[model samples]
Target: MIVKNEERSLERCLQSVQGKVGEIIIVDTGSTDQTKEIARRYTDRIYDFEWIGDFSAARNYALEFASSDYILHLDADETLEDPNNELMGNLDKDFYYIRIKNDLGTGLVLTHQFVRLFRNSPEIRYKGALHEQVQLDHNIHQYGYLSTLILHDGYKDDIIKSKQKAQRNEHILLEEIKNNPTAFNYYNLGMQYIVAGQYNDALNALKKSYTLANNYTFSQKVVLEIMKCLHELGRYQEAVKVSMDAVELYENIPDFWYQLGLSYLEWGMLKDAEDSFNKCLEIGEEKSQELLNHYDGTGSYLAQGQLAKVNLMLGNNEQALEYILSAAKAAPNVTGFFNIFLSILPNASPKELLQHVIHIWPYQTERHANLIATLYQQRHPLLNEFITYHNLDVEYPISTLHYIFENNYERALAELNQQSQKGTDHFITNNVILLSFLLNNPNLISEFKNDISLSEKEAKWFKNIILKKVPTQSIHVNKALLMIWKQLILDLIQLQKYEFIDLLISATKQAEFRLIISECLQQYGFDELALEVLIECDNSHVNRQVYMTAAKSLIKLGAAEDALFYLSKAEGVHLDFNVLFEKWRIASTIDKFEEIKILQKMIQSYPESRWAKRTSGAILG
Candidate 1:
């Protein structure tokens, strides 16, 4: 057992590995903290090693003091999750290799048991500067990569400190790469850049590593990094091409299939995308088959969620909802499940989705409050009543924004004053709350202007968020209210009603305003006016919704092909009215029959929905 300044994780590691190993040799590499003191409780065979840049040197030095025949190394940050008989039984094996599992999250875990335990011999030494692996002779054989996984929680917070450690190792790896230019070294560098959010640097380094990789062993790792980098850069076309190339190289790897499917989806190749995602499900872990029950079963929350996202992107809301529901069932406590839950209700009331979110993740009240407030301001049906009756803790800055949105200026001001005076640096939160205050009650700014010490840039940033009413500014949105406001804004704008200037001003700043306005114009049965807004926006949320709405209006105008064109552009919004529009277009050709049944079904199912009810009534009439 090797230990250092890991007082944060030492006791947990020791408790897990205790009683299993015969001899414990903890090497303290200059711990300024109480790490060595804690190490004394476990074993007296603690040795001090001076701080050196070489991790291999310190680890190898610890091995010299070990008296056991088979040495099992344990990092202070890593723990043996199941200290059962299977793990204890495996220790007696003569093989140098042992399986390792990384218990990354509480429920969502992946196993990658590497050979960590081995006989203490000169040939078996540690390699690499960072994420070092055990080097063994060619004659040595590996044990099974079993189910016993190590829980690694060291990646928590401390990002700046971690980057500092990586920067030093990156310099050392660069020197090694200069001499040998090995595939592994470059791959490591790319991973480091990826963690650091240096997308361009990661891509360049990964591309170079792919060129240098001569071994199949490192090929999968290379492909994963390249695909991830391309995805981050939004180069979906090239990403899909590269992922296909990887699948051709190694078809068995499940991650490659997952990436291939995701990239194809990103590139809007839906049928091919669905096929790729299904292949990923087929190639899933054999042991995890019971957990996966669907044709697109990803066996994990993330994979299921990804499938839902793809289905949602293709305008298959029912399928998307199915995948997301499966994910929620698999992992009820996860926040990611709510992401898909909220998205599926693109046309649902914000209050409805917010209730669902808070119901699943009850502890996430802050998130719920924000969402509730957003819905209220967007004029989602009865969102104002929901907040007033529910008595949700609106002390938070965003909650105050919602209060202001409802014209409860007194309560909103009170919340802001309390938050601002708390002396806590609420930069982002404060900025958003103040922006709402400015929009709802401009006079309040003059009253609090002396108290608020905002920089020119910060003020400008706040102004942008306030003007755009971008969802980024605040999480709370009333879907119904937003839809209604969107309709009214479009009506007022197209009808040239200057009386709704305040409404237009409030919405003009929001990212989705133009799209909402465009849709309203089309819903009022004005295709040309809606198209004018479509020409301005490039696939933004409201833009896509409006474009789809435009298709319906075009069909009404007896332009069937033009309606189909708009429907094609409504890919990202996940709009479902395209099929209905098509049916209506065909009906228009006959001029004898109306597909009012479809419209009635939609309106009956979603009565509060403007689009559904309007289209349904129009067909009925």
Candidate 2:
């Protein structure tokens, strides 16, 4: 196996392949750490290569360094499972098979396979910079699945390595796109954006790729990326279209069918969604049909597991449940299959389901917080179960806020106060924001005031998002914040809290929010009151609403020419009649009969609307 920067897992990897291969070769590519030192202990023919941007290049270089007729490559982050026994048993097999476990950052494991142990001939070489794959010249013969699996432990921590790598890769792809603009390069750039969590960029690149792609080589990939982007952007209908297009392109690929089913599920297309899921079940069953033909061999249980997943997505809880149980029974020792089985639910009691999940996957504590929320949604009394099973010492403030929203404020308050006693950082401040706005318990502002330390950025974020509803001392709470606070104050007037209005004007200490408060007063039938605030605005930097509000107020005050001046600032005659009413009033006062006729005609066009009635009254009066 070739290796680099593998000091953390090199020993386990080397020991796993021990006695399996006749010859061992270690290819190190520019290791600055103790990786080379540890690798030297395992093999005498340790070779080095200069680091290059292309992954396939490094992999091919490593392949050339190997002396054995067959080559098997493994990453530094992986360990061979039960390597000694499994390797010895499958050494002379006709076809190569490798078990790969995706150790994504969240600690979830998805196992797949690759044909890594292949003949060292020119017919096979690696391709692609990222997600490198071995290109085979001929069809596969007989293949064997090893009982042992590879343990991938790469993504234990949230690392910057992948993002840093993507930053460099995106540049290379940009250059390639300039010259070639191939569907494959765009698809690669899109995938890199996905890896870096840049969903918008991912969508742009993937959409361009999809439009340009005319062939199958990159069609499936382009469709999948576009579907994922639409899903992330909350365009569910668009996502469904992409998924359907993919299903039409590749009718047999179970993944595309499953995605189509999920899109339908999200859009509440229950019957059609279930049919799509059923297609996945049928296709997935056929995927594992070969196992039954070869009685002595293991089949692709992963595909079958996915079939169960699609069924679950379709809400066919019973049928999905059966598939998982049968799959687990077929491969009893596969822990991943058991976990999938535990996830199955029919019309089963919530308590029973939670009990089964916890009983079977007792060691899987990572999902406890999520399961707690899910159980609560199902109206299951699993709070104690969650706290006990997961040892969740941290307060889930957002979850508490949700509870308060459900009229469970007493319970929310209890959790928040308990967390405060524990002195956990950021617990009190976030809870206070939720309590003040969602629970409408202004007392939390005072209760948690001294305890909460709001940073300038955090304060600005809260002011922008949440405090618009509160709109009181939160200004003092987030000073030096420069967002225009006018409309926000106007919203407070609609909320009808006169005390909040006074507090807003006082806190702003500037004329901006006062002008907005004036608009609010006009909306509240206090047009005369609104005019006073408009006068304070300097009439220069105020927004469209400020002029509209001033026009309406001036019309109410019978200052027709002033109203006309303000109404003239409005861009078009097709504006809402609250503003047009002022314009019509001014036109009649000035005896501009033509403009008045046009305004009257507009009112007549929409006679039933409130704006029309106001316009007609202004014109006649």
Candidate 3:
């Protein structure tokens, strides 16, 4: 191994191979620290070499001192992991391809095979100044693959930052390219540019490599790097074109599809993104081994998880749900996919979510049941109104929670009817009340409100907000209960639970709440419901904003005459062009208002403006 100033990581690397290897060969390339002293703890076969600005030269020097038949190469930041000796103990081929895992410091391990173990002979020697590759006579080398991995710590962000390796690598690769000027050397320079985050430089070198390299030799890897550089540079169209050519050449590889999907996604070409990810899933199974050859999880979870986000953005909620659940199943140990599933879930009724759950994780395994229970255990939004609704008066989490978890109105309601007329458990009573509202049988709330386990303040909140048709001004709730109540209001709006929303409207006649509810409903296209709430907002005392909002919602419902009615009650309306024009437009539809009055108002407000000119031309032309 050739190293310089690797005191921090040298001892660990030496210890990992102390007992496993026959001899340790260390070649110091002018290290200013105690790296050689640390090596002395294990072996005294340490040799000093001058800094020649070429790694291959130092590595070749170390190769000359090895007395063993095979030379296993490693850097100070790299170590052979467990069960490594077994591979080293046997030798059927001239050399073996050892998998090196690069620690990206991103919770991701990148694996690539290299000819690190080989017979120590005069013919076998590493070439190139940086990112050197082992070369044999006439390029004829028998390489074998072993499952043993070498953990590399050099790529960690902190280590790279301290080492300033990108600058040094850039300098070496540029100097090497000046001398050799080969396709492989260009690819090396491109990789160094990428490490330096100089994407434009990477693209230029990689493109040159692509043009000069053989069709199949370096094209696959260079194409990938070129596409990545283009993506980073915001040249997505070029990236997609390059990726497509690669896909046609390597059709079954999941890596190309995965990369192409990212190209489309980052460009906001969502449909193409969706299609590419689906293709990854399709070819992932048949090409499972190749899928992991690059871009880990492309074959299993990455594409599936990413597809969930794409579908959600495209407004395909059901498809998004299926994709995310599939991602969770594919990577059950990865909590990130499940978190994506939660985030992608539509603000929908429990009945709507039940369909996706039943088919994905069937109730036989109790996984679907447990998943449903988990949501309710956290008391997530439950704004569903069956108008049809159950009673399992089971036990903190639920007797009614069980019924809700079942997500079955018929089964839950049947079970509830079988229970005694009144529930005995306190928390069960509270759930029964909530279930009653959820199931659209609000009358059941009266039967269980007395036995609810909620604190007295919570009871008053529940009664005043959900039960009594009075203003909530008199009740004082603590912060926690208030938060739950606010979430309930948001859920009711988001879920469009019209029946329960109507119940809340009747429970309080406060104009502020009515206006708030109306606005939220309109945001989700529930304009008719929004208009109804606005109508009950004490229109006689309401301002211009309420009147204008009500008129807009009325217009959406094709209620032009009623829109005029609300506009007629409008007060404190400023002489704005949009407001006046809308009122005039609606008024012109009916012969009810004097059009001349609005025409005069428009003319008088902005006599020298376009509004005045436009209205004047139409009025007197």
Model 1 C-alpha lDDT per residue in residues 211-288, reported as the tens digit of each score: 886464555676677887898889876787788777787676566767777776665455456677667667664523
Q: Mind giving the per-residue lDDT tens digits that candidate 2 earns over 1-621?
A: 556566767887777767766666777777777987787777787887776666778788777777666676777767766635655553665457666665653223444566667766776788766556787534564456565666676643344463245678787678668877777778889978887778999999988887887563456557766777887777777887777767786676666666666666565444445566567667754442222111111223444555566566444557777767665545443445544554463224435655655554454444454454444333233444455455555345545644543457678777777766556544455456544544545556566656665555444444444444433343432232232243334324323346656555444534555665675576446777677665433345455567777876777677878877777676343354445544554675567675567566654643323334454567578
lDDT per residue, candidate 3, 547-575, as tens digits? Answer: 87798788778888888777765634443
Candidate 2 has its poorest 10 consecutive residues by lDDT at 289-298
Please provide TM-scores, in order, for all candidate models, with all chains considered together: 0.69, 0.53, 0.56
Q: How accurate is candidate 2 locally (lDDT)?
A: 0.59
Q: lDDT of all predictions, in order shown?
A: 0.60, 0.59, 0.68
> Which scores higher on TM-score, 1 or 2?
1
Q: At residue 337, what lDDT does model 1 achieve?
A: 61
Candidates 1 and 3, the one with greater TM-score: 1
What is candidate 3's local distance difference test score? 0.68
Tell how far residue 254 is off in model 1, in angstroms. 2.1
Weakest ten-residue segment in model 1 by summed lDDT: 287-296
Q: Which candidate, 1 or 3, has the higher lDDT? A: 3
